[model samples]
Target: MSSPVKQTLKWAQKLLPACDGDLNHAKRQLVWLKEKIISDRPGGAIDDKLSEQEQTQLEKYINQRVFDHKPLQYILGTQPFCDLDIVTRPPILIPRWETEEWTYKVIQLMHQHLDKSRPLRILDICTGSGCIALALAKHLPKDSAQIIGLDISNKAISLANHNLNIHKLSIRNTVEFREKDVFNLDLKEPVDMIVSNPPYITHDEYNSLDPDVKEWEDPRALVADEQGTRIHKRIIQVAKHCRPYNNDLPRLIMEVGGTHQIKPLTEEMQINGLKDIEVWKDLADKDRVIVAH
Candidate 1:
């Protein structure tokens, strides 16, 4: 009978091979499983002295699934995104660190340019887990900003609402999660900014996604037509048309696929009359965010 921590560590080491040597991911899965068992206790504290039956049940529940490459975030049912606990479930694309990094950048940029006194409305398209929208609401001035998270999946919208309630118990800000396809959006009120992390994986590329992604995530939320550039192009065109008649167009910021995507996406935005188009790289130095004014 090994201590629970030691037992979990041992299992994590064995899981490392299946995770492509990702020790952190393996350990995170173990921790998530451990937390679930101890969740009812105050502070969600862990006890190393798990009874033999408890240890057996825990191992049986998670070990094989982890070995088969299910994403830890989905298994845990939550992912941390820019200080928000984004609830993740099946078919909703898990929030990535790259998106988190650039989302913060967008927030910082907005603070620098937008008038703090004026109320700001921002639309989040393809807001899978409401990670980006909720993060903005939590960080920005509660009284000055209105955020809407739009998604095509009803399940995602439900989960987003649950996540908002969990993470924003004392909600001082306005954040709405709605089921709306980005392809067919009609905004009654003009927004000051628009942001998204839309699907950009091409059909061919989708076949190459990791088993964890291919098996567990939603294809509609992962694949796009035309070499993964379709949704991005549509968003640019739609944003152009949805611009407020009396004011300058809403500032657009989006997460793109890669360095190759930056040129083509920026070009599409330029064709749609968007100005001040800029490409930003993630921490890995890979082109990740495209900003257009």
Candidate 2:
């Protein structure tokens, strides 16, 4: 007989078409569902066999994924980011791997460069689910950083706060979530670093995206004006108010939409007297993040 993991996946694939379906996505949903069901059970161990009840839960999740067209992350109610499982819901962007990749690296960079004696303040504009901010809080030196996540969506801000609370017992760093528009906000306290994974998809591109994405993820987190550079440019403009970073520390780090956004956004960064700039590639080798001080 196949292992329980295999049987569980086989069952889901039959319902969701995994053999030659949405490829990794279809497979991942099945795998994650199995893992989620197992981990959520009281006294359950990873090596333990799945119970009949677990299989029933998996079937329900499969129906949600296959018939209801809900994204797997949302169905799971969380997405792993760095070392934290960020709670996810509708209208708040689920954490993406690209964001997680850069975020993990950013935490490492902070450890290597930030002054340990002074309290670090980080502002995450368009914070969405607070994944980046929470990840930073979890990984950064204990009591070393104060993180604030800002979003215009009340739902997004509330969800961000919820994620922070979920990990509150373990995370010691100061973190807050506020509903504020980036375009019109006065900084009561200047931040040492500004990071964002703002909306960068154009209207045309957004319309072309899979209906599942449009239905589940928040459009305001994915679509931006000015051909996907509007929010990026605004972040660059806002970088001036942040405390400058030296010794290879980046004061401003923002996710962008590949090469098309690099030139114009970097030019705007330079216009703001930011002389040092670096473009970091995501795992896919796409220019995914721009760093400037």
Residue-wise C-alpha lDDT for candidate 1, range 136-231, written one tens digit per residue:
888775566788999999988998888888877645479999999877787777776789999998888888888889998999899998788898
What TM-score does candidate 2 reach?
0.88
Q: What lDDT would candidate 1 get against the real structure?
A: 0.79
Q: List the residue pairs that clash in candidate 2.
A: none
lDDT of the structure predicted as candidate 2: 0.84
Off by over 4 Å in 1: 1-9, 22-28, 40-45, 242-250
RMSD of each: 2.8, 3.0
Per-residue alpha-carbon lDDT of candidate 2 for residues 127-201, written as tens digits (9 for 90 to 100):
999999889998888999999999999999889888887899878799999999988888879788899999999
lDDT of 1 at 86: 80
